[model samples]
Each structure stands twice: as structure tokens, then as C-alpha cells.
Target chain A: MFRYIVRRLLQGVLTFFGATFVVYCLMFAGGGDPIQALAGEKPVTAQQRAALTEQFHLDDNFFARYLYFLKDFFTGNLKSYTGRDVFENVGSALQLTGKIALIAIIFTIVVGVTLGIVAALRRGGIFDTSSLILTLVVIGIPSIVLAPLAQYLFGIQWKIFPVNYTFEKPFVSLILPGLVLGTLSLATAMRLTRASFFDNLRADYVRTATSKGLTRFRVVGVHVLRNSLIPIITFLGVELGNLMGGAIITEGVFNIPGIGGQLYKAIGLDDGPTVITFVSLLVVIYIVANLVVDLLYAVLDPRIRYE
Target chain B: MNEHLLEVDNLFIEFHTRDGVSKVINGVSYHLNAGETLAVLGESGSGKSVTAQAIMGILDMPPGKITRGRILYRGRDLLTMSKEERRKVRGEEIAMVFQDALSSLNPVFTVGNQISETLRKRKGMSKADAMKRAVELMDQVKIPGAKERVKDYPHQFSGGMRQRVMIAMSLAMDPKVLIADEPTTALDVTVQAQIMDLLAELRRDLNMAMILITHDLGVVADVADRIAVMYAGRIVEHADVHALYKNPAHPYTKGLLESIPRLDAKGTELATIKGLPPNLLRPPTGCAFHPRCKYAQDICVTTTPPLLDLGGGRTSACHFAKELLDGRI
Candidate 1:
């Protein structure tokens, strides 16, 4: 297990570098001059441009500049060409986004797994059919549409939660946006779980369990649901990474001061290092989530042994 | 009153399919007494398994339903019992070992846990005592080094070993009627023989009534006390094991006996029944086996044959049952 974790860490590091390289290339492929994007609507003064060029080594080859970026990135000395410290900015943003994402993940898992089990048990019945339709509707409505409606209904009309966010009361502010951010993944998780649980209901083990004279609770809960968890856990892991990456829209709608919001601001302001570092963090999140999932597979299923 | 341990009286089961209601087990009846093994023999789709599932009360409902049946256990009707009441009987009074042990045993659980769990639930034993008993049960089933292998999952065991684990689990509660549905079918020939031996030994030790569901004649020849030859959803013939083998009284049974390839018949072509089992959705108008029976006569195609007693506890569902028994076929 130690060796497996070490192997995964090495792979994650490699993937991080690859992701940073991709982000670097995409900044150039974005078709706007970095100097102009940094300068905003004002006409560029030659002196300012020269200073910026010399400071960032803009005349150097892509490989050389990438190596230079890697050095600064490793030493925790990343600063955007616009002069904002990348670590101080991205780190704080990540903390808030991470918290929201964590909440969303818990919400997704608890509600999704519960609903999934219910739907599977009451298969083809009213609850199953209605939950199916409900999930389809929930998944169909994008988070963009969902955020404002949640803000209005839960915030304005009902006064259940704050309309926007206040960092002082982080948990309270997370309620609405976290739910909006988690909606799609929640539905997806529920559907994946329902499908997996349904398949497991037909598995030979379930029949064997029932034949053992086990109560319905024991058979469905212990035998069927336990076996069905592998797929659901896998989905949760992937969904966590996706939630962290995809929180920008929800953050923007609700004015949550998270990594997503920071990324949004940095992109609008065209801060290259800030945007690159955040996206690279998202990639790292994905890799780490997958690593955790692989480890969890061994924990959930006795048959899976990582040598 | 006859003290039959497990008796199925005119059991009828049907599956509601896309086409229509397909009768799977049609008026099937049989009885098992304590310390006796009854083998329900049939080919695929011949309702052998459906009968087993019905007895266990594990048939998938909606699609499959017991339209008419009374499964009497110790003179009490199991079919009319409430779900909760039936559940208590299951794994305690009437346990079942299914085919494909690999799939039957939960992959996520250790074999020890699976067996011990039943002990804990049905016997109300404590965890430690249940676990210790699980090891003993494993040892009883002839699994070597049961102490060490108890922690292993189902996949860690071989097919034969897994089936043995299933047997150990089923026997954990000391069920009076143990139904092993094609328990040895998934195993290799040698392993099949070994499992049969183990089952027979265990049956004798516990004095439990056993129902061995199988298509293998060789398997039943050694283990079964009585044989019920099922073809298309109904038992075509029933007799004591020795008598059934010596003189099969139905054409279908005769055909089945002849189809077995004997070692002495080196060059002779094997005798096979002519047609497939009748489709239950639109079963043949007459005797279900008549289409495949070589000895089938004109009346056989027009009227379904009832199971008629031929004395000495023998029964055959054929118009020419007497003729066949008299060696006139």
C-alpha cells in the first residue's frame, strides 16, 4: 500500500507538470497579446512594455521560459506579470472553494446515495419513476440557472440563507451556493448509484443472501448496497474534482470568494500566472481524488489488492 | 397422517412475459422424508430450478409467481405463511445451496463472516461463538485448514471449495430440509463426485432431508433415494432410485436413460430425445413430452397425461406407462 501510494504521488507530480505545460500553451493560444491583456484598455507605453518584457523574460524561448516558470513555481515564488502574488491569492481562494466543495461532496453523497437506494428498492414503482423524472429535471437545469433561483427562493423569499456570502460566517454562506454547485453531480451520483444498485439486486450474491433467510434490511442494506458502493465511490471521487473545477459559475452567480471566483477575476484581468496556477491546482485535485478512489477500492472490496 | 418432511402439492408456477403468461411449473408434486434425498432431474428450462426456487420462496415475483401451490413443511403450509413467518423458516428449517458458488457467495464478505452471520441471525449466537462455529462448519464441509482459510473471501477459494463453503453456510443452521439446486453442476466431474460424497456424508451425519436438483443421471444414481424425472414443467415419472434406473416407466425417462453414454458402448451413437422441451408460452396441446417421445401414440398428442400411481410408490405420466414398465416399448 505504501508503494502504491508512492507510485500514485509520482504519477500525480508528473501529471501536474503536464497540466501546467498545457495551461502555458493555452495562454498563448488564447490569441490576445499578454502585454496588451496586462495593460487593459489603455494604450501601451513603450517604457512599461520594455520593463514588463525584461522582467518576465518575454524574449526567451518557450522551453527556457517554461523552465524558469518551473523554478519559480517549485520555490513558491510565483507572481503574475501584473504583480499579484500567485500563492497568497490562489491559496486563500483554494481554501474557500475547498470548503464549499467539501460541503457539496457531503451533501451529494448523503442525499444521492439515500435517494439512489430508495429508487432501487422501490424499482418501477411511483417513487422510482418520480425520482427518475426528478433527477432528469435536476440534471437538465444547469447550475447557472439554478444559482439565482436558489438565491431568490431560499435567500429573498424564504430568508433561509444569506443572499450572498460573508466570509465571517462561512458555513451559513455555503448552504445555497454549495447546493447549487452540487446539483448536477448529486443527480449523476444518484443515477449511477441507482443503476449500480439495480444491477447488484440481480447479482447472484443477493439471491444467495435472500436464500439465507436474511431479512430484507440485511440483504438490501448489507449485501446489495455494500456491493454497489464501488461504483458510487468512484463517481463521488470524480465528482469532487469536477465540483472544485466547475465551481466558477456558481461562485460568480452567488459572489462567493473562492478559487473559482479568483480564477474568474484573474481571467477577466488577464493575469497569466494566477489563471495557470489555479487550473493546475484543479488538475492536481483531479489526480489526488483519483488516487484516493483507487485506495478506497481496496478498502471497499476485499478482492481488490494493490500489491 | 403421513409425516412427510417437505411436500409440494400440485404446485403451479408461471412467469408473466412480454408474450403472455408462461407456465413454468405445471401441477408439480413431490415429497421428501427425513434422512432421504430426492433428486428432481431435468434438462435446461424444464422447471427443475423453478421448483427449487419456489420451495425456497425466492422466486423473483411479478415475472414469476406461484399461481397454485402448497409447500407443506412438517404438515404446515409454507406457501400460505406470511413473508415474515416464511423468512424465519428459510435458512433455519429449509436452507438452499445454489449453483455457481462464486456468484452465490458475496464477494465483499469473508466466507467466515457470511457463514457466521447466518448463525448469529438464525441461532442467535454471539459473534465469537458464531465465528468459532463457522470454522467448525467449514471443517465439517472438508475444507482444509479451515482456521487459516476462514478469513479469506469467496474468490480466494476454488469452485469446488466455494461450493463447499456454500454448503457449510447452508448447514450452519442445521436446516431440516436442505435443497441443493444443481450444487455440483458448475464443478468438474471429479469435483462433482467429491461434492456429492460430501453432501451424502453430511446428510447421513445430520439425518437431514435433502433435495438434489440436477440433470446428471450419474450424480443422482449415487446420491438420490427417489428420482422425479421432470420434462417441460411437470414430473414425467417418479420412482425409487434403484427401480427408476432399472425400469424407467415413461418414454421420456426411457429416452433420458438411453441417452447416457456408457463406457462399454464404445462405438454406438448416443440416443438423444428428438425435440426440445415444449415452449411453455404455447405448450403443445397434448402431453408436453409427446413431441419428443419416440413411443408417443395418437392419443398422446391430443390429451395431457395425468400422473397415475403404478403401485409400490411409483408414478408415471404417460398413457403407455404400463406397456413401458412391462418392457413392451
Candidate 2:
């Protein structure tokens, strides 16, 4: 197991460098003046431009500059275009996005799994039909459309929740947007769960378990649920990175101060340092999520030993 | 001792499909006494496995419905029992070993966990106690290195070994009746014999009544005390094993016997019943097997023969049963 984990981490490190290199290449491909402050409203003097150029080694070739950026990035000396520490800016934004994603994911798993099981148990019945329709409608509604409507109905009209996020009650502010953010994924997970549960419920082993005098609850819970989770877990694992990407839209709609929000600003301004660090973080998230899922497979199924 | 440990009286099983309700088991009846092995012989779709499923109360409902039947266990009608009561009787009093051992056992669980689950749930044994008993049951089933192999999952075991694990699981509660539905059908020829030998030894050792559902006459000849031959969802003939083989009273049974390859008749075309088994969707008007029976007569085409009791514990559902017995057909 240790060897397996080490191998996965090694692969992840290689992917991290490759992903960052691609992003760097894309940034350089634009062929814009690298030393210019794209965000600054003030006109720059020649002396200021020359000073910035010398400070950043903008005159060097692409590979030389990339190597210099890599050295600075590794040594934690990389800075944003606005002269702020890139690590400090991205780190704080990351923490907020992490919180929202964590809550949304938890909500997704609970509601999706419960509804999925219920739908499977009542297959071809009223509950199953309704669940399918409800999930379809939720999946159909884009968060862009859902966010403003939710703000109107629940925030402005009903006055139940704050119109925008507030720092005083961080968790309270997250509830509505987190649920909104989780809706699409919840519906997707529900469908996957229902499919996998239906398949496992029909398996011969389930019949064997029931024949052994197990109660209906035990039969479904222990036998069917464990068997059905393989597909569900795999889906969730792959969705982790997408969840963060999705948070960009959700945080924007709710005006939440998170990494997704920072990412939006960075893209609008085309800040190379901020975009590079933020995107690299997403790549890391994707690689780590896959590793976790692979490791979980061994834990969930004894037949899949690491060896 | 109870004369009949388990009995199915005039059972009628039906399958509701997209087309219509198809009667699968038409008034089939059989019984098993304590320590007796009754082999239910039939081709596919003859409802042999369905009969066993009905007995175990594990029939997939919706598609399968027991339109009419009474499953009696120790003189109590199990059909009338509550779901909870039936559950109590299922693994504790009567257990079943299904066909395709690999698919029947849960893939993710260890063989020991699967066996011990019933011991823990039905028998209310402690975890440690259940584990110990599971190891012992594995050993009893003649699985070599039981203690070490208990930790292995079902996929790790070979086909024959997996069947042995299933047998051990069913025997966990020391059930009075064990319904083995085509248990050896998924194994190789040599493995089939070994499994049958293991089943026979287990039956004798446990003093358990068994319903051996099989399509092979050769398989039943060695282990079964009595044979019930079914055709078109009904028992066409039933008698002591020796008597049925020596003098098959029903023409269908006679046809089945002749179809078996004999070493004495080498190089000859193997005898085969001319037509296919009757489609249960719309069975023939009179005897369902008439189209496939050479001895089928005029009356056989107009009326379904009742299962008549011929003294000496023999029953045959063919009108020409007596003629066949008298060598007149």
C-alpha cells in the first residue's frame, strides 16, 4: 500500500509539472509585453517599464523566463502582477472555496444517496417517476438562471436569507448557495446511484442474501448498497475537480469571496501569475482526487488489494 | 419423526409477462421426508427450480406468482405464514444452495464473512463465535486449509470450491431441508461427481432432507432415493429410483430414459424425443407432453390426465401409464 501511494504521488508530481508547463506556454503564446501592468489604470513612464523589465527578466527567451518562474515558484518567491505575494492571495481564496465545495459535496452525497435508494426501492412506482422528473428538472436548470431567481424569491422577496454572503455568520451564508451549487451534481449522483442500486438489487448475490433470512433492510443496506457504491464512488472522484470549476459560477452568483471569485477577476484582467497559480492548484486537486478514489477502491472492495 | 419434513401440495406457479400470464408449474406436488433426498428431474423451463424457490419463499414476485399452492413444513402451511415468520423459517429451518455458485456468492465479501453473516443474524451468534463456526463449517465441507481460505473472497476460489463454500453457508444453521437447485450443473464432469459426493456425504452426516433439482438422470441415479420426472410444468411420473429406472410407467419418462447414451449401444444414433418441449405460453389442449410423446393416444389429445396414485407410492400423470407398465404401448 505504501508503495502504491508513493507511485501515485510520483505520477501526480509529473502531471503537475506538465500541466503548469502547458499553462505557461499558453500565457507566453499571446506575445504581449510580459512586464506591462495590464491592470494598472495609470500610464507607465519609460523608467518604470525599464525597471519592471529588469526586475522580471522580460528580455530573456521564453524557456529562460519559464525556468526563472519555476525557480521562483518552487522557492515561494512568485508574486502577482499587482506586487502582492501570489501564495498569500491564492491560499486565502483556496480556503474559502474549499469550505464551500466541502459543504456542497456533503450535501450532494447525503441527499443524492437517500433519494437514489428510495427511487430504486420503489422502481416503476410513483416515487421513482417523480424522482426522475425532479432530478431532470434540476439538472436542466443552469446555475446562472437558478442563482438570480433564488436571490429574487428567497432573498429580495421573502427576505429570509441575506441578499449576499456575510462574514458574520459564514456557515449560514453558505447554506443557500451551497445547496444551489450542489443541485446539478446531486441530480447526477442520484441518477447514478439509482442505476447502480437497481443493478445490484437484481444481482444473484442479493437473492442469496435474502434467502439467508436477512431482513429486507439488511439485504438492501448491506448487500446492495456496498455493491452499488463502486460506480457512485468512481463518479464522485472524477467530479471533484469539476466541482471546484463549478464553484466559479456559483460563487460569482452569490458574490462569495472565494478562490473561484479570485479566478474570475484574474481571468478578466489576464493576470499571468494569478492565473498560473490558481490553475495549477486545480490541477493538483484533480490529481489528488483521482489518487484518493483509487485508494478508496481497495478499502471499499477487499477483492481489489493494492498488491 | 415427522413423516414429511417438507411438502408442496398441488402447486401452481405462473409468470406474468408482457404477452400474458404463463402457467409454469401446473398442479405439481411432491414431498420430502426427513433425511430423504428427492431428485426433481426436468428440462429447462419445467419449473423444477421454481418449485424449490417457492419452497424457500424466495421467488421473485411480480414476474413469478404462486397462483395456487400450499408449502407445508412439519405440518404447518408456510404459504399462510407471515413474512417475518417465513423469514425465521427460511435459513433456520430451510436453506437453499443456488446454481452458479460464483454468481450466487457476493463477490466483495470473504467466504468466511458470507457464511458467518447467516450465523450471526439468524442464529444470533457473536462475531467471534460466528467466525469460529464459519471456519468449522468450511472444514466440514472438506475445503482444504479452511482457516487460511476463509479470508479469501469468492472469486479467489475455483468453481467446485465456491460450490463447497455455498454448501457450507447453507449448512450454517443446520437446516432440516436443503434445496439444491442444479448445484452441480455449472461444474466440470469430474467436479460434478465430487460435488455430488460431497452433498451426499453432507446429507447423511447432517440427517437433512434435500430436494436435488437437476436435468441429469445420471446425477440423480447415484444420490437420489426417489425421482420425480416433470414435463411441461407438471410431474409426469414419480417412483422409487430403482423402480423408475427398471420400469418407467409413463411414456415421457421412458423416452427420457432411452435418450441417455448407453455404452452397449455404441456408434448408434442417440435416441432423442422427436419434438421440442412445449411452450408454456399456450400449452397444448390435452396433455402438454402429447406432441413429444410417442405413446400419446386419442384421449390424450382431448383431456389432461390427472396424477393418479398407483399403489406402492407410485404416481403417473399419463393415460397410458398402465399400458406402458404392461408393455402394451
Best candidate, lDDT-wise? 1
- For model 1 chain B, give the 10-residue run with minimal summed lDDT: B288-297
Best-matching candidate per DockQ: 1
Candidate 1 chain A: minimum summed lDDT over ten consecutive residues — where?
A: A26-35
lDDT of 1 by residue, B130-172 (tens): 9999999999999999999999999999999999999999998
**Model 1 misplaced regions, further than 4 Å:** A29-39, A43-47
Assess each prediction's global lDDT (C-alpha) against the native.
0.89, 0.88
Docking class of 2: medium
**TM-score of each prediction:** 0.97, 0.97
Give the alpha carbon lDDT tens digit for every residue of A133-221 in model 1: 99999989987789989999999999999999887778899878888777778898899989999999999998889988999999998
- Every prediction: chain A TM-score: 0.93, 0.94
Q: TM-score of the A chain in candidate 1?
A: 0.93
Compose the digit string of candidate 2's lDDT tens values, residues B206-237: 99988999999989999999999998899999
Q: Flag clash pairs in model 2.
A: none
